[model samples]
Target: MTFKSINPANGEVIASFEEDADYALKIRLGEKSFDRWKNTGIEERIKLILNLAVILEARKAELAKEISLEMGKTLKSATAEIEKCAITAKYYCQIAEEQLGSIEVSNYAHKAYYKYEPQGGILAVMPWNFPYWQALRFAIPTILAGNVVLLKHAPNVFMSATTLEKLFIEAGFENGIFQNLLVGIDKIESIVADRFIKGVTLTGSNLAGSSLASLAGKYLKKSVLELGGSDPFVVLADANIESAATFAVKSRFQNAGQTCIAAKRWIVVDEVYEEFLNKVSEKINKLKAGDPFNTESDFGPVARLDLAEKIEGQINFLVKKGAKKLINGVRKGCLLTPTLLNMSRDLSHSFTEELFGPVACIITAKNTDEAIEIANETNFGLGASLWSQNLEEGEHLLQKLNAGSVYLNSMVKSDASMPFGGINQSGYGRELGVYGFYEFCNVKSYIIEK
Candidate 1:
């Protein structure tokens, strides 16, 4: 079957491509290629990885445009995403030797050390949001460490998937070092079961992660999942109200409010709750939602009309359950304006669900204890941001949060220097930093008697 990537900003067909008709043959080629690639030295891999940053910079404008057209994100944000991916590629190159090289485990008991060996092939299931950025987190580190990859990107961003494949090819990757497959999700189960695919990494919703992870588990293959999140932005009484409110707007509304790490729930202490609400409402009112290609637009489409519909349904459900809208806004096509809601603390849908759009739901807490209680009440434990003037107290309270990462006074974001992942239903395994690159490696131990 053929697929066409439709521009959400204007509903225009950007490009059409046929799906991989012979995935079996593709997997065979990938497996065979991995056999050869696995033996390559780390020095050669680093050289090729370093070249990616140069290539990405040369074509940054064109690539950023492609991203905006396909996924309907603001041009500025799209460019930032691509630039971050480029930076991450360079970072992996810099630490590859030290991170993946052999390490002495025991020097006296014979000669003993630990070596990182590559698994044959991996299947990457990625989402449309931050398409290039999400995929590169796994692709650069995995491919640079000497493993072949088959990317199963979201159908809506197939243009991005193919574009990235071209980038790797231009950057001197081997034929099967990195390839994009346009097949449907149903194909993933069978692909994972294939002897060639040694592991799987996915960045998507909780439902998608669960189904795919279970299938991979059945096959006894390693799996790393970066799933959904209901991240909290907590505002305490002692916080700098103006600064906290500004960052709250940024953390919640950036990327049109379609981020897993975006602050979806605002749990504020009662002491300054009203003042914080007024600040956020004013900022939300000033946001301009328009065409993604427009440089000055504050918000853009949410990737797909169906996804927009899903978000509206979520909002309506919460509204019926006593969640009242403060600054009501409507949705047009895939573009949703900034919406603010005063969420009920009665265990309603707003607190119990993941709002994956521009709908900001606020809940007032009696004190700091209640704020944290509300923050940790979700099934997702991805990330959380705490706001407080007492930085040391914020640090101590941060431990009470049950997420993979916690920021004392900033938005939770993925960085090449820090390990990023979540526990509980948000999924397992980590990405980024030295810990991220080693997720797919076979840490083999070797010892020789003297």
Candidate 2:
């Protein structure tokens, strides 16, 4: 099978490449390179990562263009994404030594410490929606910890994948230290079963996570999954309605609402529901949806036509089930206007489903307690943003929300300094921070007694 890198905005094929026919050879090369890479000094590894960061910074313009052309994100957003990758590389480079350093477990009598060791190759199944950021967030730390990487990126973003592989080599990494396998989903199981592949980490849908996780379990390999999300954006009566409304639009509409961390559901307390709705509706109307290459456009089209169709189908299904379309969204091929739907409280099933496009579902909550209840009524616990003027009360309410990360008076985001992942169907394990750096490491304990 051939993977075509098509521009989602205009449906033009930018490039195409045949699937990697010699996948076995690629895996073998990864196996050979693991020993050499793992044995390299941490200082040298950090130096190479810094070099990679420099290259990412220097070539960000061309790289961002490829990303925007392939994935339909605005050039500004794509440029920011590439810059974030570079910043994260530098972040890990600064902290890798301490994060990966050995820990002393015993202070008296006998010497005992816990040391982190790389466990060969890790297979990363990355998604296309923030293609560069998604792949590097996992790869940078995993590689810095001395493990080799085999990337199986989403087919639609194969061009970005190949470019990433080239960047690694340009930074002076050995051929197999980081390899991009162009094979499809069918080959994932075989790759996971390979002795050279020690673990698996995937950032995609729940269905994809389940299949690959089962394979990892069968092969006795450790796995980390960052899956889908229906994260809620809660607004209280006393909260800064204007600021909350502004950030809400930014969070829900950015990336054309394709992000896993994007706020999919909006739960506003009845006390300020009308005010919040009016502000958001007005803000949504002003959004400019146009060519991704245009600097003035606030957002671009959805990554593909099928994705737009799916969003449209989901909106239609909800409208049939008694959901009110407060602000109608117009769809043209891959471009979709920002939409707002006022959802009834009884629509429990739709609340659980993940909606991936630029449509925000608004649910009115009677009060703060009810708002919390509505926000927690989903299978996804990825992330949530709560707005309330009462900092103490909001801090206390944080314990009640069942999410991986909750933000007060701010939008939900994944930071290099924080652990990012979710609970329940949102998938387990984490990415970023110290926990992510140690996910694929062997935490071996060393002890000696005289």
Candidate 3:
């Protein structure tokens, strides 16, 4: 089926792309690319990615505008996302050699070592939220490790997908090192089932991740799925309410709250709940939501109309379920107002479900034990944040939180230096850091007798 990507802000058609490749063709292309890319050394792959990073840095303004226009992210955030892509690419390039190099081990047996080798080809089903960054995070490492990639990007960000393909080509990459497949969702199962695709990686919703994981399991193909999150932003009684509130606004409202790692649930101790809420409300009120191209704007429209509607539905559902609305919801075109709900009970649908927008659900607890209980109640365990005046207290709570990463007095965000992934229904495997690079590699142990 052919789909057209429209501007979420005004419902204007931005571009229409046809589903172009079938399973057989995708398999053939991937196989062909693998033969060439797999033979290319890590140093050569690093050079190609470094060239792409340079190209991205030079055209940051142009690429950022395209991303903001197509996805409705603020120009500033879009630019930052673009810069992140470049930085990630350069990071992988700089470390590919050392990270992927052979490792030596000294033991009782004569000589033993291990070599990190790449898988043949990987199928990447990327989301549009952070269009450029998500794609690069997967592509750079996989390619640097000598693996070719087949990208099936979200339909809404087709232009960015095509632009990414062109950037690789311009960077002097061999044909097929990275190819964008303009295919519909129906074709994904067949593509994943293809023998040429050694593995799969996805960054999307929980349902999407589950379905893809099931398919990958059917074929016993390795997969890394990074799904939705209801990350908890905990504020202890002894914490700095003002500082915590400032970071809370950034964690919740950044990217219009489209981030998977974005802090969705705020669990504040009753002792400081009033002060924390006041400071957070003030910060949210000060944010400017308007045209993404406007320099003064701090927020932009939701990625699409459907998403905005979903956000509205979630907020209204909470209100109808008897949750007190501290800040009422608002929508203008595709833009959704920042909303905060005071959820008193553990209503199944209240703050438990993932609401992918600028809505923060505040749950009050008497102490740290109650706070940790509420945080672990959700099925998602992507990431969580804890705020406390005592560093030891924050670290202690961090150990109890059932999440992949925990931050102390900071927002939950993915960094190249840190491993990023989720536990439970948030999906499996990881991305970023040395562990992420090793995710796509086959660690082969070699033993030599003296």
Largest TM-score belongs to which candidate?
2
What order do candidates take by TM-score, descending?
2, 1, 3
Candidate 3 residue-wise lDDT, 1-450, digit = tens: 677888877889988887884546756877888888888877778888899999999999999999998999998999999899889888887787898888999997699999888878889999999999998888888888888888989999999999999999999986678889998888889888888788999999988888899999999899999998889888899898898999988988889989999888889999999999889988888888788888888788999898898889878888898788888769987998788888874763345678888888888999888988888888899999999989987898799999999999888889888889999978889999987677777889999997
Rank the candidate models, highest lDDT first.
2, 1, 3
lDDT of 3 at 40: 83
Best by lDDT: 2
Pairs with backbone N, CA or C atoms under 3 Å apart (clashes), candidate 3: none
List the candidates' TM-scores in order.
0.98, 0.99, 0.97
Distance from true position, residue 186, model 3, in Å? 0.8
State candidate 3's TM-score.
Answer: 0.97
lDDT, model 1: 0.88
Clashes of each: 0, 0, 0
RMSD of each: 1.2, 1.0, 1.4
Model 2 per-residue lDDT tens digits across residues 1-450 = 989988988899999989999998999999899879989999999999999999999999999999999999999999999999999999999999998988987577488899899999899999999999999999999999999999999999999999999999999998999999999999999999998889999999999999999999999999999999999899999999999999999999999999898888889999999999999999999999989999889999999888999999999999999899998999999999988999887894455678998999999999999999989988899999999999999999888899999999999999998999999999999999987789999999888899
Residue-level lDDT tens digits of model 1 in 154-251: 99899989989898889887778888988988788889999989899999998899999899989999999999888889999999989888989898
For model 2, the local distance difference test gives: 0.93
Worst 10 residues of 3 by lDDT: 344-353
